[model samples]
Target: MKKYIKIARPDHWIKNFFIMPGVAIAFLLTEHSLKDINIFKLICAFFATCMIASANYVINEWLDAPFDKFHPTKKNRPVVTENMKFSVVIAEYIALIAVGVILSLLVDKLFLITSLVLLFMGFLYNVKPFRTKDIPYFDVLSESVNNMLRLMMGWFVVTDSSLPPSSILIGYWMAGAFLMATKRFAEYRMIGNPEVAGLYRRSFKLYTEKTLLASALFYSLISTFCLGVFLIKYRIEYLLCMPLVFLLFSYYVAMSFDPDSAVQRPEKLFKEKKLMLLVFVIIIAFMILTSVDLNFLHRLTSNSLVWVRLD
Candidate 1:
């Protein structure tokens, strides 16, 4: 029983916080006040997301047990260490899916559809014949798409009438990609042996530390560019947060260089007090920017074609 629960990885559900950004963005874009929100529906949306994510984790653990043995830390996971019954694992996965589906029904139609897509993505990532996780860069992009899907789930919970801005969605996806690439880089570094890492993850055979870092750089650059467009188009006030954003990314990159990086275990990242503090500060800043309108920022960024008198 304990093993079954452990395989669900409730602790890792912190990743579902990604959904909050969608909620926030929805509120911001829709100009909704607190009174307008359906709190019960929001709670249902959150739990539905958590349940589906757990289902994904269950399947991920079961399927990756073979490869996880090659991982130093992951070798200790319940699936790899315990003699678990296949039937029980399948039951757990189905149960979680059922719970998620039921909860999603309480939310809007778009949320329900997004949750289903999130579940399907887990199959595409972990199941054979379509396991994009085996493909080098595709692995990163495919996994990161969950970030966008989760965001959409949050957005739809608030309003199903319209989609999120493409610029912000693209930025969020690229940001997730950057984070995923960094995680891979940290894991590759910790493994310290290319052959061993390759055995653990098929994508590693084609990934070098330099290449991974380069990919991370590319992802960050693209994220920044898209996010900049979003801010310029929607809320120029967020431009004030850009410096902190750069600092956050640079700080994360530095953390990946550590011998034991928390990037590999984001669920345990509270151990890095300074990093968590920075994240908190960034969140506060974002919240403030979301509410306040800086009209002067628009004035500053506005294009004013000055007329020069020509002889």
Candidate 2:
């Protein structure tokens, strides 16, 4: 059981949190009553995504086992440590993919499309010919595309229409890209060998501290702008919460630059108590402020007549 859990790569499950933003943005934009929302369908979408993502991780680990054995940190993974058999991992992958596909099909056509796209992308990331991560820009592009698909999956599950060019979605995408770039930067700095970096990822050579810093700064600015726009568009009084977003981005960028502090594994930062506390505090504060003026903000902008009269 322990081996199976390790093989499942529970640490990667954190990525599933991507589902929340779409649901939150959809609710914020549409103002749909909670009772009317189909929570079950959303849950199904979340589960299906988790299964598919986990399967991808398993396959990736299996394929990279040889290289991982040389990685300073990744060498400790169950697959690398010989705690799990490749055959068992393969079986799990097949089962996960099967269940993920069936569950996704049960939802809607949009869900089916998103699931298939994710599966194909995962295969392309790991397999040859279309091994996107081995290419130059395609590496970052593939990661960003997957992130966008995950965000869209949630939006499709909730609302049948295509997601609008909302500030929240844009902000989320920028943040995701920023994180991806930082991950590559950190890996390059930690390994100190371009060949090893390239072994793990194809875009490692393209990243440098200066380039990464610039990219991070650009994304941070765009994210902040998008969040501000979201608040204004929705007439949300919690625009003040925008500072928390800035702080979070700044903290991560600061850590990413410090060789000792910058964790090679991007997911490790989330597990750190101090970092998690800071994130928790910011989220709690934002929630409180947003909830406080919720009704008033809704009333001020919800009625079409109110906007016309103001004009």
Candidate 3:
């Protein structure tokens, strides 16, 4: 059970929290409501995303084991350490992905499409020839689009009645890219030099601390601009929340300078007490801003959990 769990990399499933913002934002936009039934469906969708993502992680580690053994830290993974058999890993991937597909089908068509896109992109990301992970800027771009797909899945799970604002989706893309670049930056810094980093990730051969830091900063700035646009259109009251986003980005960037920043594995970010508190504050702010004015959004937000009594 433990070996299987290791292959699942359940700890990293935190990355799939990307799915929540979409559902929450979608509910905030036109619906401003979250049905108990919708929450159940959204849980299923979240599970589907996690299963597929974990399958992808297993595949990536399997293929990367050859080089990962050389990494200072990745050497601990089951695949890299050869603690589990290759055939067992393959079986686990199939089972998890199969269940993921079934769950996606339980949602709407758009959800199915998003699941397929994530699966297909996952294949391209770690597989030979089409492996985007080795392509520098394109690597992060491909991964960022997967974040968009996760958002789409969350949106579809609730009200497929309409699409999220373009601004939110664009912001999601930049934020994902920002995270990915920072991860690379952390790995590079942790390894201490390009020559050593390149041994684990081919694209590192083309990167430098300056470029990675610059990219992280640049993408995060774009993320801020896009989110600012979203706030303007959605609920300006949410603008107050923007500073939290900026701070989160900056905090992670600062952490990346450490030899072993939690940024390397996103789940670790929450392990930091202050960062987690800030995230909690952001969630609370969203709840407050959901129906800032009694406009149409307020009407929908009326029955939302924020205002609804459990009784």
Best by lDDT: 1
User: Candidate 3 lDDT, tens digit per residue, 16-90?
Assistant: 888887877776676456553466677889889999999998888888988787689888887765477778888
All-Cα superposition RMSD per candidate: 2.2, 4.5, 7.6
Give me the overall lDDT of model 1.
0.92
For candidate 3, report its TM-score: 0.89
Which consecutive 10 residues in model 1 have the weakest lDDT in total? 302-311
lDDT per residue as tens, model 1, 182-260: 9999999999999999999999999999999999999999999999898877888888998988998999999999987
lDDT of 2: 0.74
At residue 110, candidate 1 shows an lDDT of 85
- After best superposition, candidate 1 residue 213: deviation in angstroms? 0.5
Better of 1 and 3 by lDDT: 1
TM-score of each: 0.95, 0.81, 0.89
Per-residue C-alpha lDDT of model 2 across residues 97-164, encoded as one tens digit per residue: 99889888877788778888888888898777777766654565576667767877877777766564
**In terms of TM-score, how similar is model 2 to the real structure?**
0.81
